[model samples]
Target: MSKYDIALERIDAAHKDDPTTITINTTTLPYELHYAQQMTLYLERLDPNASELLRLAIRAQHLRRWEIPRSSYPATKIGYHSWRGALQREQAALVEKICVESGYTEAEAARIGALVRKADLRKGDPDTQTLEDVACLVFLDDQFDKFEKDLGDEDKIVDILRKTWGKMSEAGRSEALKIKLSERGECVGTEGFGWLSVK
Candidate 1:
């Protein structure tokens, strides 16, 4: 098989071993595996011309996330940021190792790792922006309603939407507006993020 295929196979194998499972559309899948699949789908929709490295990075964005539970860090915002930073580094390292083992060069592996690590986000790097867009789109498409319900606070939900909206590019925001949120989610979303007008 090709290096890219081999790397994806290894990543899928690891995700398949996740002890947790979720049912989607009458099929049960490992949670991380399902999440990875969603990320890839969103990335494809966001940028069909994305580089192979970006594709691989998106697929492995949350590699073995359950291994690092959020409870491991403090419950403060600072702790949340710290936990995310650490996860990015850990996921990048794991993906790089897989890339190298699949016959990719160190430089190629490093590029993939950098994408997974979200390097140069504030600098407006195209690949990083694409990744961020995909992430936000995935959240909006699949997780927004559940997230809003779980939070149960309009202000907090709006705050979250504002932050998510800020991270998205225009293309991403356009796609997000197409998502069909629940009635309440749509109402809160429209109120919280003025850019969206849900019908």
Candidate 2:
């Protein structure tokens, strides 16, 4: 197998042991593994010409995420942010290790690590931006319906959509516009996220 395939295999193996399962289309998969697959699909749709490093980073974005439950952190905004930051570091380290073991050079591994950690998001790094775009698209497409149901507040839902919209690139926003929201989410998308509509 190629180095990229080998690295992906290692990442999938780690996810296979997640111990948390989600059923999709009658097929059960470890939640993080399913999530990784979604990220890769969105990355391919968003930028088919993405580099090998970016591809690796996207595939391992949430590697073994179930290992670090949000409940382990304090129940506060600060704690939530802290937990997310730490998870980013942990995922980056794991992906970097896998990349090196799969024949990537140290520099390439570090680049993938940075992308996993989302370094320089506001600095306009193309790979990091693309990763962020793919993430936003995944959330909008796959998670928004469940998330909206849980929140039960239209204003909060729109706020979340607006925040998510702000993080995406024009291309990402265009993709987001195509998502078929539930009735409540559709209202917010039409009223608040309408600005994202392509001409």
Candidate 3:
């Protein structure tokens, strides 16, 4: 197999350890593995010609995420941000190791690590933007309905969706509009928030 294939295999191996399993279309999959697959699918839709490094970064987006649960930190917003930052750092390091093991040069591996951490996200790098867009698309397409139902707070759901929407590029937002959200999801950002009319 190629180096890319080897690296991808290693990433999926790590994801396979996730204890959290979710059933989708009658197939049970480790949650992070499923999430990674969704990220790749959306990346293909958003940028079919995505580079090797970006593809590897996307595949390892949530590498071994269950190792650090949200409950490990406080329930405050600061805690959430802290936990997310930690996850990004950890995932980046882990994927960098995998890239090197799969025969990538140190520089290439480090580049993939930066992509995983979204280090240039604020700089408007096209690859980083595509990664962010894929992440948002996955959340909306694969997780939003269940998340909305579980939260059971329309206001909170809208707030969360608004924040998620704010992170996407115009292409991402356009793709999000095509997702078939649940009835409740369809109502979000449409009542009065003219800035985010997903419907």
Candidate 4:
């Protein structure tokens, strides 16, 4: 197999260790593995010509995420940000190691690491921005319903969604409009993004 295939296999093997399980239709998968798949799926839809490095970065976006549970941190907003930042760094380092072990040069591994960490997102790095877009798309497509139900506060959910909306590029937002949302999800999206007119 190719180096890309080797690295991807290694990444998925690591993802398989996640204890959290999610059943989609008749197939069951580790939550992180499923999330990684979703990230790749959205990345392909968003950028079909995405580079190999970008593909590897997207595949390992949440590499071994369960290692750091949210409860390990405080419950406040600062805590939430801290937890997320920690996850990004941890995943980036882990993926970088995998890249190197699978025969990638240090520079290539570092580029994958940067994409995993979403470095330079605010500075308008195209690949980093696309990674962010795929993440938002995955959340909206796969996790939004469950998340909304758990939160159970319409106003708060809309507030959170507005923040999510602000993160996406125009292309991401446009693709988001195509996702099949539940009634509640649609309502929340409409409220959060007044321009979202997804029929």
CA lDDT for candidate 1: 0.89
Better of 1 and 2 by lDDT: 1
What is the Cα-based lDDT of residue 49 in candidate 1?
Answer: 87
lDDT of 4 by residue, 64-146 (tens): 98899999999999999999999999999999999999999999999999999888898999999999999999998899899
Kindly list the per-residue Cα lDDT of model 1 for residues 1-199, writing each as its tens digit: 9999999999988899889999978999998899899999988788898888899999998898888889999999999999999998999999999999999999999999998889988998999999999989889888888898998989888988999998998888888888888888888877777767743
Q: Pick the candidate with the highest lDDT.
A: 4
TM-score per candidate, in order? 0.96, 0.94, 0.95, 0.96
Q: What is the number of backbone collisions in each predicted candidate, taken in the order shown?
A: 0, 0, 0, 0
- Candidate 2 local distance difference test against the native: 0.88
Q: List, residue by residue over 1-199, the lDDT tens digit for candidate 2.
A: 9999999999999988888899988999988888889999998888999999999999999888888889999999999999999999999999999999999999999999999999979899988999999999889888888898898887887888888888989899877777776776676677765753442
RMSD of 1: 1.2
How does each model score on lDDT?
Answer: 0.89, 0.88, 0.90, 0.91
Cα-based lDDT at residue 152, candidate 3: 87
- The parts of candidate 2 lying over 4 Å away from their true place are 192-199
lDDT of 3 by residue, 8-120 (tens): 99999999999999997999999999999999999989999999999999999999999989999999999999999999999999999999999999999999999999999
The TM-score that candidate 4 achieves is 0.96
- TM-score of candidate 1 against the unseen true structure: 0.96
